[model samples]
Target: MNAVTRIGQVGEKAVFRRHHRKPDGRSLFLYGFAKPDGVSLPEGNDPVAKGGELRWHPFRREWNVYAAHRQNRTFKPSSAEDPLAPSKPGGAVTEIPFETFEVAVFGNKFTSLHPEAPDPPEIPGVSSQPAVGACEVVVYTPEQTGSLYTVGQERRRLLLSAWNDRYEALFQQGCAFVMPFESRGEEVGVTLHHPHGQIYGFGEVPQVQRQMASAFDDGFSLERLLPQWSEYSVDEAGGVSAFCPPFARFPFEVWLTPRRRVPGPWDFSEEESDGFAHLLGEVTRRYDRFFGRDTAYMLTLHAAPKGCEQTFHFTAQFYPILRAPGRVKFLASVEQGTGVFTVDVMPEEAARTLRAQ
Candidate 1:
């Protein structure tokens, strides 16, 4: 079992406290806000000064968020001015005020959703609503650099535990669906160079996730999928598994799931947590070595909506963009226009390549 201690609060939102946790007997801290005291937080750069709003796309029949404010987000800054780093005693204050800490979680300064979003002006034939939800940044480490793969066993375990805690917390905070995803490298459009991930608590379920849940309703189970499309069998450790599915969009996309039905990261037992951490870390490490460099990738945790826990199996998917060394796979016409992804490499070949390495 792990222990969590509420340390202190940061910013005007005093209720957002810094939480400390002990995973594998090592200490880890999670914060709720960035920007040190006395220093004003950077304001967003939306020329229209529009807060986020959700508009329904008639053709897609899904909601899209309009967050024009994110344009001014901090781009790749020098190592000295890295915002995710812990603030030093006399040094320029960054996000975290502590001189040193382990894992940290803070609300995104350039948020896509808001707790108090203004109502959108009514447009004829358009269903518009306020983008009301939460967006959080989870800092993997106090160190400015390194991928989640290199964060070590204890740290990784801490991260998993923290994620579990967050899943429960965010749901309680009124999120219909909580998504934790990481976008790495400039190819993936990652603005921040800092090794961190974002967790968005969506007020409504995204269309893709809704489609996956619908698949489960149509009698698709892990047992059926595994027999039909199992790419990597090396994921059978601790009852959780990872495999490259038949319909992977990216070159080397992999899906991680539990052998038994589990709703989300919070539902994992102690041993299952350890297993998932190992499997996830191993997958990431292999991905980095696959291209002989840090490959640009997107990792997402897909869990059932709050009510559909028993029916849906929680899974994590990784989509590394690089099809070959120094080459990136760009999603052009077919993928962008029709929502249908045309991948060049077969799942079998991609799985074989990853397994070989």
Candidate 2:
């Protein structure tokens, strides 16, 4: 049995989604411009695994999660063994059972957290608890090649809408914080070559997010800060702005945010959504064109924690690790030890280079 929902519309095409449950009890959903064609869900023979636990970090005043199962996840598979690809008519079943799909989302098999996670083992003097949350993988397309930059405009818009849906769903399920992010290329330690991203729902807001909330409560305003770096702007349209911040930690770091503060992607107006998709594509294309190759980067969305929505500003930050075509800006001793980032290029110069692309 399947359940269908009307997601929204892009241009003249109406987007819809169909949900399925994998044999191991994982949830899967397929999204497309048209209704999905019926297909038999595959029955798998894998064992159901348990989730990990979180240990308190005394000094940092944070939690660290340990999921030992992740060490055995699929790594660098050949094209023939790409698990993210859609299953061929008579081929071996993959993570996605669909014969064809525009986009796919499913529960991560080696997730760090789970709703039914067992209680943590007792460690004499240490604080610990079950890591109860959610982790999901979002496949951008059926094709295994090409990055988000090459997915075309309409698909990117659909991707954004899908992310918005996930955010709302996860929050309703009791997550305190949700983050959608993409780790691309080997330099960024991406084990899969497929064009996909992941969404992590945390039981509590992490350290960085807590810091952002504190700064906002103390009167930090992105609207006031953005104007000081107008010369570093890359693109702005439909109430959104994409620019390299003057205090960039990476050489080619770029931050995209709506002109007016919003709690999260779900709060984006229709026009802001379109502009976001356009700017996301533009920033990535510029990175590839400027470096004369596919640049390795980490892309993340920063939104307010569930209860702190009114005080936080939403932003998408792109941190490309490449300082040059072949050189990487590794976080060495000074960076790791002192928490200070040392960059080799200035934000103005980086913006000038990207704009030329």
Candidate 3:
């Protein structure tokens, strides 16, 4: 079956991919464009070509990227100069040159990793790599301002399809792990206010993801806990479930899982993809209702490594940082120092609030 609507080239190294979904009997457009552009890729900061370095932390036994060049990325621009928007008629060129498009994806001007780069200079005690990986931007809409939750069902479905395509493409390029996520609101330190998300294709598995893989290796079955572990089940359709886990670190955290075990987004059945999109939109709506306004949050997908699909269960987690309408939840000393999160509201209570909304 034909899945992608349109596939073409944008700027250098950028690929434009679009898809459509007929939801509620109406067709909607969702397009994604990927490219690499820099208003300021001054001499030494081009991570893709040079100076992209990764260092191994001996104590943590993990890899950390040292791309100081990302400090110069685009920050808070006026609506007229929104870089994520499509290039308007007779207007300053933005990342996308196309005038009107539903959705777009492109390479991030500032990325922690690079898709291709030379190996970093090795040290005696420290191991290092070239920080080679891919970071692409996914714009949800052409509108300058709006939350992803406010987008229509068809758009959300298209977004899911786009993500699946990216995951598949990135994996084929030899990325070990792929993460598609969003950071919303100023509190989350989102520099540009545009409605967009990002996908990071890592050459090596991240630490947190490594831990999840370890759990599966130890015979922990997330499938077994799916039926009973959720304190608040938000939506269960097409063998997919969205719920608030009892051990949630964030007050209003939600997890999405498929009833049947699947390795990654690429493994999702058509029915499961539709249901997943529906639940995603539903949960976002509930978040807005609970807060009585736009909610600042972070959304992330954790999938199994490229080769370890059968053992690991792919899941999506949404972390809304707002405790009240105007109040925000700040991770203080304890959360940062000890890595133990102390939540003010219980997951059960958070679920109740969401359900009521």
Candidate 4:
């Protein structure tokens, strides 16, 4: 029978995973996409043919996995008399078909939907009429058998690592700005619980993205300093190191820095990608385990816009909103109308919880 591991002492996925210390140490976990309806793992290492695999979403640049939808994937505390709390027994894993796409450039321009967005939302940091503005999606895993948080760290990192492959190709095709934004689980407001979807593009920068770029005046250089920074903590193939600001904003949010400074996703090389695969797996799994496994999440990429290689730092920002069993910090008056945020739990506390896993 195909085997699946459960969370451990701390009730988190990390407890079940042992980080490797060699270049190939992270790849030690034998991960294969599981087939649906109690099917087994595929014969080869071919990711596309695996039953429980992850692939890219063409519309959004984010990744999706093939796993069974968990029973408590959604968040509707008021739905039933006793709703599913953050801590509960999740459903069995779901598996689905896996598909990956080659890199391509897409624009919001000239598409059938262009006239429809006739007026894109007037964001604060971007231009209303810019040279380019497009959006696309990428699905990572198709293993519909488990919640996104249930996948092993090795597999998770590999799935995230795919971005390096396509980002380089897409940037060449004229994509100036790309951000994979994602929301998971129905209870937490995710539309699909079936492992999938994210968005990106080649065009005018989103207002927020432009503002973030302006944070640095001296143009950065991924070419000059990326190699050393991509995976700061990992030199050996299977290192157990991770990177990020010691103080982060959210629980278990991790940034993969293979080289010292990557201007953006397009500049990441093979080393960065491999490190990302390992780290991402570690981070995602820990997030769910943080709030009683299978927690919902959202991750964002903070990188240099297509042309501004000199002005930005290519970093990822993972936003996992699940604070506890049944509570989330509501974005009330102070946060909604006004652009401010406050967290009840300190980021350090969140980090500690995650690291424990």
Return the top candidate by TM-score: 2
Candidate 2 lDDT: 0.88
TM-score winner, 2 or 4: 2
- Best candidate per lDDT, number? 2
lDDT of 2 by residue, 187-215 (tens): 98999999999999999789999999999
Candidate 4 residue lDDT tens string, 31-131: 12321122222221222211122234444433333333233233332322111111122322112111221111112111211112233345454333322
Per-residue lDDT of model 1, residues 1-357, tens digit only: 223344322122222234432221212235333322222222223232324999999999999999888888888888888888877666665766566566778667678886666798899999999998878788988877788778876667767766766788889988999998899989889877888998898888999888888888788898556755655453556778878887788888888888777878778776777778888888888888888888789999999887888688889999999888778898899789987888888888888888877
Q: Model 3 — which ten-residue stretch has the worst lDDT?
A: 35-44
* Minimal lDDT window, size 10, model 2: 40-49
Arrange candidates by lDDT, descending. Answer: 2, 3, 1, 4
TM-score, model 1 to reference: 0.86
How do the residues 87-170 of candidate 3 rate in per-residue lDDT, one tens digit apiece? 766786576555666676666666677766567676887788888888878888888887766787666766776787788878
- Sorted by TM-score, highest first, which candidate order results? 2, 1, 3, 4
**Model 4, 347: alpha-carbon shift in Å?**
2.0
Question: How does model 4 score by TM-score?
Answer: 0.56
* RMSD in order of candidates: 7.0, 1.2, 7.7, 14.0
State the displacement of the C-alpha of residue 275, model 4, in Å, after optimal TM-score superposition. 1.7
* Whole-model lDDT values for every prediction: 0.75, 0.88, 0.75, 0.43
